[model samples]
Target chain A: MKSNLELVNDCDQFPPNRDPSFLYRFMVNGFDCPFGYLLEATVNTFSWPDYWEINHDGKTVKLLGSSLEERNKQIHDTLLAERERGSFKILKGWTSEIFSVYGPQKDLVLSIPRIAAPLFGIVTYGVQLLAYQSDTSDGAIRIWIARRAKTKRTYPSMLDSTVGGSLPTGETPFECLIRESAEEASFPEELTRTKAKACGTVNYVCRTDERGGGELGLFTPEVQFTYEMELPKDVIPTPGDNEAEEITLMRVEQIKSALGKGEFTPANGCIVLDFFIRHGIINFENEKDYIEISSRLHRTHAFPTA
Target chain B: MKSNLELVNDCDQFPPNRDPSFLYRFMVNGFDCPFGYLLEATVNTFSWPDYWEINHDGKTVKLLGSSLEERNKQIHDTLLAERERGSFKILKGWTSEIFSVYGPQKDLVLSIPRIAAPLFGIVTYGVQLLAYQSDTSDGAIRIWIARRAKTKRTYPSMLDSTVGGSLPTGETPFECLIRESAEEASFPEELTRTKAKACGTVNYVCRTDERGGGELGLFTPEVQFTYEMELPKDVIPTPGDNEAEEITLMRVEQIKSALGKGEFTPANGCIVLDFFIRHGIINFENEKDYIEISSRLHRTHAFPTA
Candidate 1:
């Protein structure tokens, strides 16, 4: 069985050989308020369009547009052109959705197409909800777990949190959670809004794997707003969309076993481990790596974040 | 009012001018497994006792002792000599307690006297418990808060968690929590052992401030094991020792006001914030720095920890 710390490290893989020299800071303001990390290959291969500036000496990339609108258009046009020419395979997964990027002052610097986020190693935000119900007789807690549909592009047929989705350009994490809960888990909006508690967040800087369906070495720094909802046993969640193939209630021990067997997606495993820690199932006496596991779930990064 | 992010930043003060060049790594096991950070001034001023070597070129400090026993003795003897000579004012607060240090592999590196830890910028561990109860009529939560005795050396007269203490060399966080619950809060050992739930941990690399009662700019990387207990309404906590001057139950709103007013110790403020976040009193919609505050509470550091 994998140790809890190993499970966390798998999600937050900071490679020992990750060379800082090959990274270009994604600068927004005149100061070094970096929002993303651009690889040397990415900087060298991309044709420098009119609004983009690359400082070779400083290893920094900046948008030269005078306004946010122009900056957004500059990225949109460049990625659209890349998709049209089939220059970068990553653009093929474009969903036409945009993600808001923030600078040091917490101002929205610009929005980038969802497919192009990993290309610049931008920080992406998401919401994940772990819906559980109590077994009143035994006083045990059982969580609602979802299995992604085999037809899904990433982590297909793998276990996931009950509800999860990326935040749209202007959506708050709470708003995103409400929408995803209804779409993915057939949960009532009122039920979710009233009961779901924003527990905390899980953060990681992961290098995209083959399962992520992206270019290798793509840096994906992510912040996942985590929530927990205790559902009445009668209000069972059914799959409401193709995102999930099936949903089931899992006891704590079963979830632990699945986590050890690597059945859940890396990010989902981290969320589950965090849930267990907060619920006092996996604790100091039971897990030797308790402190390390808890701390690693909220890893810090160099870039600016919202 | 101070924002939630500001409360977190107050505890995790990573100065902009923190220079890596002036810091020396504590090396062990033929690798760069640093257990502490040594400032240049600390390196230059300290007399190099036997079994201790300073590599000026590499900016590294290593213990040349053949075994852990010898390494422990080397540090003990050096600090004892410094104390006798009245060389460092920090030695005045020595409690004769030792804190266990760990290497990269989580192996026990060595133990250092408590007061000498910050001088070497070593990682320290502690246990903090927030005991609370629910208002039967409204279902509102009220937490037991303690004011540190004015006679206390550190953070005197400031608010603190219900039960807290530093982890001694051989004590587990759970054991320490149990002991502190009895000594600091006058709670029965059995009640604490059965009721307290290990929520998670809060980590930060903080520079010592005036209230810390140490030399300025002392790097104190800390990991606090946090736990929470739901107490029955009839059972109120009373001050059992001189560590606390008073114990009172405060509603969530009152706690928030106090937190904003900076009535709590820096570390205790962090613990309270963590409690509020976990209990859902602080949510994504209510706090603008939701993700930033949650992630910052579990800040990552370079030094090895247990």
Candidate 2:
């Protein structure tokens, strides 16, 4: 009964996801529309086109499919023009953060965390893009874990943004992604050039209190845009500057092995890695073999099966 | 037979390839060093391993099947170990202007070209990174080009490098690339994460001044390096403030078409596009074919096949 944009505007609006603490910029609509214009009440939560199903809440759920939908929306017509080509849907979403507003609006300025700060303090949302597979050779999905700088201020030495940075201010999640990738790698800024398209968004209430009280322990909710970046064999994980220390390529066997060890850290890297390995990006040579990295985290959400 | 670096230094160099006129920097070694640098060189030139040829000078040359013996003499096992696994092989050379000061260092001071400036003249050289192809889809050779700014004080809007630039004082061409990509794209400084690997060298001369008033035209020589960057599809091409007016994605098909229509403009862009297209890094199906911009002049060089 209502448009997706209308529904997006209904949800709590953040300039880049509305949280000042987070450092990323993202755009909402085709024409660079303002934040909060798309009410959350009108749009559906989101869903992976292929594996979407009903939840206990009995409402359609979407996650990691926002970018996917957005991608499809852009090239749907052109792709359909080529009958032989298979279609990939792109989903869009606003991954926002709410920073506490204090002091006078006139003199007060916005800021982002030192670790997440963009060249400039800009906040935004991104559209998650993804691709699906049925029987890939790897069997297990591949999770790309970005090894953080050992000396990082937050989430130090943990994997973050396999999909990339948070949304940038005054830009859409997609735009934020273009910026993120540039900052992250020597990659060309053409987002749609390769198979690295938007897949969808994963809606989850992520709370990070790894620091205990105050300072780094602040709690905040986040909507993550999952993007699909297909790494060719030659593309080894080489991190850029302090943003990433190294990129640990993960496979499912390692995930299972780590979970068995029972030493789970609060860092979300393992969880995300588990998702990738289960989804078939990473290959498991032997059902019994595993990598040497930690894998003790519990799987909060297992990949959907057909 | 001089050492590879010496041979590279002895070969024609693009003196104009730098800032502050007369300062020259461009050389490439044809040998594989230990340290796995071969792959890095290969990746730098050709976007894919399949697009490369060991005996690049002949029809028998093939990628993925080069024997160690077939590699250039400069390539030794020790050097090979230093190379990365997926790099490209580039061809570098110098211009005749560099030779003018050859016998001994002539007191030379050149200014680097500036936009509105009392043009800063710098000794600039022409370095071309080569991306090899089999001959056609099954076997033809090709290269890439960048449409230059026509109003440029030196080269103007001619198609210069598929991706190239002059070296500033004290900076290597590889470093120049880091500066170039950022300058061209308005990209963040972090994007220049990867280094450009030295491929090989080319020796040739260009006739500059057609006036023939005893003030002979500037003779050109060059040295090019091949750099590989696995860019995300979303990266945009924003061109530098002084270099390009706009960036256009052209394919070999378009180049062939243009060549057919008696419209051979700068062929470098199409040449590089052909390399990437063959490697599966770029797809013409997703990009718009070349559209008519304006009539521009282009040059074709015929060097003995190396």
Candidate 3:
């Protein structure tokens, strides 16, 4: 019997892949290092350090550094100079505000500026915690969301997760969660350490705006480990620093609508949506892209293992 | 204040990234296609068509064709010839047993033998319906899984979803479900059409074995549109054809163990695990990789939009 096999080439062929934005590359020296992303334009920028060279064929760029010391020194000094020249600005609300640098198989232990993390397309690790509470005995859930201070740089005035901070090197996600919870929202160290649930991670790749004289700014590959804390009805979230302007409680539907209208930071929206899926606020029957959305929340390729 | 920006350069500094196992290429007229995947060896002991040429680059191969029509004709005729020689056999109970041939954009509408799908990394699409029931008045749930006949080819005698069939070129997923349920499980078309709930879709990519010597086989990229049908407590499923040996009802825990022990077909196991998540049997609290598993079920890269 003849079967009607479908003829499908899912990766867009004609108009090119709608997203040619993110490419994976390793900076090579003594070993292959998972360096951050670089724009096609940035790769072609001339006057690279004498010890380093780049090879790219439209898709990916391999940064060939002369040595680990040469590479680290070149990147650190050059990137800092660029930032001082107003080429990059810090995302002040991001926690820990440290960068994760890696050498093949081990932590390089050299953290760059948080704002410069994306310029190199390095996988910037961070922690995000969502604190929720049920006011009534009926178990109706309410979420606590923070608003970034307008005075802060990068996505200022945008809605954010309840508590989040950059994952500094030499720190585990759970440790960062406890620290950020206490510092960002003034959560008791004990409550955050005990009640927080490890939800999941969100991975995304995107291009930075034209930062250096129209040079292809680096592509940013980001990975954030997420957590959720169900607080009692009496718990209140208070901002400890300028990382947040204010913390407010929001209903699930309100958060959903705001996310739909794109009011929250891109990453927070993803983390919140994941909470909805796990909490049973959203399911397959109600959403057509339920499976698709759920999958996007995890950065499967971001981490090597737990 | 000194921020903790730990320095880490993660990757091989001297050596290039290992495991460069797959490559992507497009087949143009008289030129080699930069398609993805490099097999360890050519499929079976058979002579390839004279018009077709394959260039090897370590692991990745470039499939060059004299023309678009030439490439299509060579693959189509060659695969069919091998199947006729008993090289590739039809997988019974598969609705659309046709392989889809694609290069760049636009479907050539050229369908190949279904058995050759995975070898070429072809993204295959199909429909699967999970017919379940809640017998007790206490809102307890039980699932229906089918066992394939021992004599069938491919994963024979393994457990599978309640109702599943390949998605042919012209048929919509809903329509395929209605037809497959009737033909495979003897379900009334009306009940399937009316009672079933559209869950979502699952996407996956897997490599297949070679068919012709040293030729590029199929790389199976599969997308299955899934549905859930909650049947009446007393309804009994009978096999309409020999595709299934028998249908058995299973509890959630039993199915989990079977999945863990690898008793079910790989695809079926994924579908059922998705069922458990939506049904609240498996969740973030119980499953550490809940988000990861849920996301892996959907081919995030497969869909252009969320």
Q: Identify the leading candidate in terms of lDDT.
A: 1
Residue lDDT tens for model 3, B27-135: 3343233333323443323345665444444433334455556566666677666655654333222343555554433334245556555444455667887888876
Error of 3 at A159 (Å): 2.0
lDDT of 2 by residue, B132-164 (tens): 233345433333335667676544555544456
**Which consecutive 10 residues in model 2 chain B have the weakest lDDT in total?**
B290-299
Clashing pairs in 1: none
Could you give the fnat of all candidates in order?
A: 0.77, 0.00, 0.14
lDDT of 2 by residue, A1-306 (tens): 322112222221221212332222222222121111111221232222432232334222222223434433432332233222321111111123322111111111232222221111122223332222323476534545555677865556644544366554345455666566656654456633444653223332232243322223122333444455666555544555567676556565554454344222222433343234323222122211111110111101111100
Q: For candidate 1, lDDT tens digit of each residue in A192-295?
A: 98999989899888888888776788788998899999999789899898999999999888999999999999999999999999988988889887777887
Q: State the DockQ of every prediction.
A: 0.75, 0.01, 0.12
TM-score of 3: 0.58
The candidate maximizing TM-score is: 1
Docking level of model 3: incorrect
lDDT of each: 0.85, 0.32, 0.60
What does the TM-score come to for chain B in model 3? Answer: 0.74
* DockQ of prediction 3: 0.12
